[model samples]
Target: MVEITLKGITKRFGNFLALDNINLKINDREFMALLGPSGSGKSTLLYTIAGIYRPTRGRIYFDDRDVTDIPPKDRNVGLVFQNWALYPHMTVFENIAFPLELRKVPRDEIERKVREVAKMLHIENLLHRYPWQLSGGQQQRVAIARALVKEPDVLLLDEPLSNLDTLLRLEVRAELKRLQKELGITAVYVTHDQAEALAMADRIAVIKEGKILQVGTPNEVYYKPKYKFVGWFLGNPPMNFVEAEVEGDYLRVYSSRIPVPSHYREIIEKLGIKEVILGFRPHDAQIVKGVGDGLLGEVYSFEPLGREQIVTISLDGVFIKVFAPEEESFTFGEKVTVEIREDRIILFDKEKEVALEYLYKD
Candidate 1:
């Protein structure tokens, strides 16, 4: 196990800044994921850590040793690529043993390590099969086994399951999590999938425009996002945003003003915010009968999901999605009020578009 530290890490591709002043610490034996949309520098950061792409500036440390200048093969880290990069002509055994062979390990030692990971991944029976003959999931396991055979201090996976089918991806996700916990090997995963990052990592680092936006446990990032982008980027349906005005501690959403929660009262007074953005997740909102304590809207669309319905309501001009229980039924263009959970409300500065939760007097 190794603790990985990156400080002032910056990467440039000629004129393009791939990573900008990135600073992060991945603890020993911790599963950390770098998550973001495409071209967001997540892969670049992962490659830099894997020693595949050297950063233009900053230092990288493994434990207490500086390894920024180390070559990819000399970094003592196992890397699995998105494409799996399996040798089509080589048997599973040969593919898994290639890394060991490159390091000039004895044949006997290579055989033992190769068989061990194969058995662990339940691919032992396919050791003699070539890459072309193996299933996608089986091939992915082979790729992972190849990386793990060397038993390096760090394991890096770049969208390792992106190529698999949905069911296969779910199966592999569990396998990957189980293997990481069973071996307690430090891992860094890179992907654009929010569910993948949330499900697999001990902590998730959300990156955007080559900068780290936030890093926290799944619950932290999900429940208490520090920025508007973090809140909007995480949820399955993502968070809904409304342009609101702070009119004497109350938020003016559309024509009606909603009362602000008491916990945020002191901070709201302190910040003296004239304009603020109200953010809430689809699950946090509920469709109520009357408009007594909620915002009014007409059911624009109702999507059924066996257990419940995802109801999209047209609020004046803005549309918001609400998760409704299966027992509830709504007709098209039906009017209803949405009760936004006060405690779960996320307030962001209208100008800066950053959460104000940290400014409150707790």
Candidate 2:
């Protein structure tokens, strides 16, 4: 297994900066996911580690060995491309054995390694099938077998399941995570899908426009983001932001007055932030019938999602969504109270667009 490290890595395409001073340590046998939106430099970062694209500045290391100048073939890293990159003319066995063949392993030994990896990926039965003859999921398994047959110390995958259907993606995702754990190989997976990173990675590195914004476990990045963008980018329906003014011991969000919890009062005072953006997730707040000690809003609209429904409430002109159980129903233009969960509130510096240390625990 290899612990991959990038020290001040930077990449440039002429005047365009693809990566900007990236520093990360991916642990030995860790499943690390590079997650972001399109054109966010995630793919470029993965290829840099694989030795396909050398960085313009900085060093790449495998464990303690410097491999900045090593050729990809000598790096002992297996890479699975986004498209699977299978040769249509080759049989499954041939595709999986190609890497071993290039290294001139004995014919019998190549067959043994190929069969071994095929069995591990459950593609042994499809060894004779050509690429054109297999399903999308089958093709993906074949691609994985091809990468794993060499028993590489580090494995890198670039959105390997993006082409598969929803159900197929889920199945392959579970299998891939299980396979990685079973083999105990250091892995770096790249994807724009938030759910994939949350489901599969030991740690998630959230990137944006050639910069890593945050690196943390799914829960940390989700519930305790360091930046407003990190909180905004991670959640489905994302996090709701409202303009507020700090008024004595309370925050005046539009017409509602929410008392600042004691835990966050000192931090807020220390920062001397008069204006702030209050952020919260959909599941963190609740809607109640009639007026109470909560934000006054009217039910604007809602969408029923089987077990639970997403209800959109209008705080004056601003809208925020709340997750409500399916059994509880609300009608349009109905006056309701939106209650904030005191412990779940996130405070962001309005001018800096950065999160404060309000989540600090006693």
Indicate which candidate wins on lDDT: 2
- Candidate 2 lDDT tens digits, 126-186: 9999999999999999999989989999999999999999999999999999999999999
Off by over 4 Å in 1: 358-362
Alpha-carbon deviation at 234 in model 1, angstroms:
0.9
Per-residue error (Å), model 2, residue 324: 0.4
Q: TM-score per candidate, in order?
A: 0.97, 0.97
TM for candidate 1 is 0.97
For model 1, residues 1-362, the per-residue Cα lDDT tens digits are: 99999999999999999999999999999999999889999889999998989999999999999999999899999999999989888999999999999999998999899999999999999999999999999999999999999998999999999999999999999989999999999999998999999999999999999999999998889988988999888987889998888888678888667898676787788877778888999999889865656777888999999998899988788988989999898898877889999999988888778887664433
Please give the range of 10 consecutive residues that has the lowest summed lDDT in model 2: 353-362
Give candidate 1's total backbone clashes.
0
